[model samples]
Target: MKYQGSCHCGQVAYEVDGQLDGAMACNCSICQRKGSLMWFVPRDQLTLLTPESQMATYTFNKHVIQHHFCPTCGIHPFGEGSDPKGNRMAAVNVRCLEGIDLEAVPVKHFDGRAL
Candidate 1:
């Protein structure tokens, strides 16, 4: 399935093709702080609908994930990284997706902090 997402201020937008069935909540420092439920997909499955200049990238710790957020609204709609197998991947913030019923989705908790 395809979904549309954007930052709170609408400065950053994107489209992602994937199923949200495996949405996850990571316990890592950043994910824990943001409280975002993410859906993982291949990098090629995500398309930025807005200009890159409108977003800011953040990295820390292992710095494997490029957390992209809207500087204006400070909303992290999505992030990019490579999987353990070195395959390009993207983490889509399910909260940012349009018409998403977050209450209905079961979130799988990932113990990223332990890694």
Candidate 2:
């Protein structure tokens, strides 16, 4: 399935294709503060609908993931990183997606703080 998402102000928009079996709620510093429910997909499955320059990127800790957000709205819509095997991946914030039953999606908690 394809899902459309964007920052709060729509400055950063994107389209992601994949099945959202569930979302991961990570209990890391940033993840805890932002309260995002993430759906992971291959990087190739995500298409940017707006200019990449319109969004701001932030990284911390191991600095492996590039968390993208809108400077204007300060909303984190997605993040990019590589898996253990080095396959590029995108973590789409399901909370930023359009027209989805968020209540229906099961959520799994991740102890990112322990990493």
Name the TM-score of candidate 2: 0.98
Whose TM-score is greatest here?
Answer: 2
User: Total clashes, candidate 1?
Assistant: 0
List TM-scores for all candidates, in order: 0.96, 0.98
Best by lDDT: 2
Instruction: Show the colliding residue pairs in model 1.
Output: none
lDDT of 1 by residue, 17-68 (tens): 8878868999988999999999989999999999999899999987889999
Q: Write the per-residue lDDT of candidate 2 for residues 49-85, one digit (tens) a residue.
A: 9999999999998899999999999999999999999
**Cα lDDT for residue 64, candidate 2:** 97
Off by over 4 Å in 2: none
